[model samples]
Target: MAQGQSDPSCRRSPPPGGRSLRQRYSGDHLQRILLVRGLLKLLLVVAVLAGATAAGWQPATAWWAARNRPKFDTLAAEQGDVIEVINSTGTIEPVQSVQVGAFVSGPIVGLHADFNGEVKEGDLLAEIDPRTYRAVVARDKAALAARRAELERGAARLQQARREEDRSNALAERNVASISESDLDQAHFTRVGMEAEIVMAEAAIEQAEANLDTSEANLGYTKILAPVAGIIIDRKVELGQTLAAQFQTPELFVIAPDMRREMRIFASVDEADIGQIRLAQESGKSVQFSVDAYPGEVFEGKIAQIRLASTTTQNVVTYPVVLSTPNPELKLLPGMTAEISFQVDRRDGVIKVPNAALRFYPVRDHVREADRVILDGTALEADDQARGESPSASAKAEAEGERKRRHVWVVEADGLLRGIPVTSGIGDHRATEIVSGDVEPGQRLVVGVAPKDD
Candidate 1:
């Protein structure tokens, strides 16, 4: 080769120690280029997948939320009668009950009355053994007779002393007896000893007579006479039962007086509900009750009295209320349980709404504080006057007297809901009377919204 020129094969490629660019890359260097190309392809695939996921995520989320959204429940305001009531439980009892018991202690020998036997006043119910009492009477009688005989003997002795004194005085006047003899006879007649003996004997006779009377009276008690007319519901003693009235009188029978007459019910009223109860006889309101035995039948009664005494159980205070009802057929029995209800107040033809509507609250996000309507009694009264419905003094007082502020939700022409402040009266728990409010009948109100699925 020349100094500045090379062979053609060498010039067409590279020098002997170097390589051409295509040949250099065609060796182990080609592996590095292939790796870079694979990396770029992987990056393009990742970018496509991320773009597709981003494009589809929003629609799926929206579909899930729309499928699970809760719906609202609403109720219509209505016109009806709303009656407030107080409920209680009571025990049936006779108007008059008498406990027949043994006044004296003895073995019962006979029974004239039994369970469910009707009897009259002064009728014999049972008989105690009267042998011992009869013996007592006999002994007292003998003592009385002896005392009477002793009194007679004392009188006879006094008579004899008087006769002897008279004879001695006559003999002394005829000079046939000594003055000392006459004086001794006179002393025997005038002495207080015979008079005193006679008086003591009479007193003894009187005491014996009184003791006999007492024994007889005690014997009469053994007959176990009924004090009042009634039915014998309980018999505590059988024949040959011994009653020992040591500390307290032994009960023999329980008498329910006059089952054909009226009956009584003793009811326990809770302190929270006691203010609503009054004597039905005074208020002319009837009380209705039902028994477990007669589930479908309702009996009527009148309040007799409200007990002032209170009883406490488990920190809950209650008072006893008495009610009376006629039992001409004698169907109501003693000790029967009665479910009682008393009418506290009543309002007719009033605009009313379901209690659920008054108790509903919208979700916090759905309501704004400014949209809430809260009206006091004065404001409600002014609204009523503006509407040409003038309220009475008593009605205004009743509204002001209430301590609770009731509210109900009413749906507006818009899709949103707003609260309406109201004065309510005569609630039956299922429905309530709307005394004064901006709401009207046929208005749709929200009762409750369906709970969220989550």
Candidate 2:
């Protein structure tokens, strides 16, 4: 028997149904069974891989998030003063100012004072030409003298009239002269006419004297005098300038009273902030200000007056607040712009944090639900819902009346952020006072998330 030939027992003959046994169990049927087994093994391997991935998805994602998170910028709570200030702008002016003007009109002949000249009260500031006034005075004096002479002449005539009347009356009584001659003499020597002429002459003399006195006063007025002791900030008249008093009095000099002694600031406080200003004229709160002329140099003053009348510009209403300060060195000038601030409140030796800390919010991935601390309100109940809990009814009621609740984050020893809710008292733009909180001085606080690199 050949090696390749099969035994007669192994080689099956055709069956009675006309199909051989070898054909019934062919290679194609075995190949189909092997393929089905291979498919089952591949499905089992895929199921194992899916199970492994499901078991590690959470930790893998957590690790990735930890590595890719943004680092935060931090600030430490400090112990210092926090002052709340109300800001405003104003102009510096002298406490007292006067405008010197000419009372009499004449051509200016002499200038005794110039710009920036110091003067005292009753000091001669300028002189006007007195020729016209002097001429009027001379004319009035001559007229007065002429009127006095007229009075003397009238007095002599009155005396003659009186003597004549007496003689006529005596003649009538004696009966030595005719009655018609006596009557004619009495009519010619009427006493009322002589007395009337004397009165008229006296009236003319009085009028002439009054006119002369007026002319003398006008001549005296030609010398202009300083009304107040001050420094002349402005001189408007020239040596040859002619002033006219027919209309309004033209200003010749502007004097600032005691420029080296004191100064005043007129600040325009908004209507909304006027209520915050206290009456400080009689030793109330003090205010601080700075001028552009002297940078970084602060000057202090007190409120002198708060005008009740409001001024409206572009529909914005403001009130004038007067502040006075001493300027002994004369460093401040009139009309210089000053930036002012009123300290409304201040706190010292309190734990304070940057305003950025109070306003900082972490990204969604960085928020840890287990680390939230709600201090003084039930407003966090919505946030608690994620933890499968709801706030109590008492907490909800208390939240309605609770003072504002603010929070800041502190870094833990394990390099994780934890929130600390605090009771805030006072605040400014840069810092806020922490009245009650778990934080203390010298603690690092998360102010803001670090900016990303470009």
Candidate 3:
């Protein structure tokens, strides 16, 4: 027998109605191979399916990201002019404010004006009780008449005394009277006394006239009138209210000069931003503002004045900035708080990129590898070394080098990211001024990255 041949006694025979041992073994082996092959084919199919699903998911995910990724509208930075700086804030105020008050103590008899009442100069706003002033005027007039009558009588007595004194002196001179009789007969003393009486009467008349004039003034004060053309903002006096002017002039009303013209805004600029503020006449910075009352509406104004006086609150010093705004429709009211922004700087007709482009950081190894690839492909070794320098140092070097040294990633026409070098200038938190770059206006700039799904 062959070395590997199986003995018939050693091999187990098949049971009745069953296949032979060799046949059974062969069948079992074939079944196992088939099972294994089927299992391998199933595994291959499963792997292929998994790979296809992964490949299909990649583009969907990329498309979803491309569609949903944050997009920024780019602006062009040109050689056009830009304001260097601006800073300010303030409340709206009327150009002129007046406090209408009473000049005399009296009871208010009538109120002719109230809050929001429009008034002109010399308009009667209120009237006070005039009874007491009227009585004073009448009394002073009577006293003045009495004093004038006394003055006339004294003048007549003075004339009579002068005549009598002349007659007595003539008698003494003719020896018809003794020396004592001449002294006693002399009417000069009586004449002087009468003249003095006339002087006192004149003085009394003058005093009465003064009193009458004062009473007249008090009577005039009974009518409270507007001193300026304005609208009434406040009315403190009421009808039949007694006011005492002895201590202070009781306020009757408060008026603002104009509501249709320009208004002043008082805003405090932080110390950090104060350097930017200047007179509107000088800087010509246009300002826009909004208040809580009108959230979506923007109000326009010009910088009027920058006050030198600085106010310190909680140890933070700020300068007051005044802005003049028109209120043709009277939409802005006094005391409304405003949030203001001064257009300090702008670059036009130049390449502008999203601020995030300048801020984005690539992997350190990736940046080095990209630089190596660029240098290896280029013959200009000196230029490539210069380009490979740190951004800050390069920025300080030649201006063009500063512009051409920095790079940002842009999705290429082939759906792959590529590096584009650029030079950047002034930027707000939202956008950056691109000094030099291949980027164009209206091109989309990536602002953020989407997180990879697990």
Local distance difference test, per candidate? 0.83, 0.83, 0.75
Q: Which portions of model 2 show Cα errors greater than 4 Å?
A: 1-63, 170-189, 279-283, 361-365, 370-405, 411-419
- Model 3 earns a TM-score of 0.67
Query: For each candidate, what TM-score against the reference?
Result: 0.74, 0.76, 0.67
lDDT of 1 by residue, 1-454 (tens): 6798867875555656687566666667888888999999999999999999899989988887666654568889999898888888999999888999888889999999999999999999899999999999999999999999999999998787777667667767878546676576566656457788899999999999999999999899899998999888898999999989777899999998977778999999998777778534467788999998889899999888899999999999999999999988878999999999898788899999988987886764454455533434446757777898766899878756663467787655444567787887778869898889888899887898767665
* Model 3 lDDT, residue 317, Cα: 92
RMSD of every prediction? 10.7, 8.1, 10.5
Candidate 3 lDDT, 8-64, residue by residue in tens: 899766787687645667777878878999999999999999999998998999998
The model with the greater TM-score, 2 or 3, is 2
Candidate achieving the largest TM-score: 2
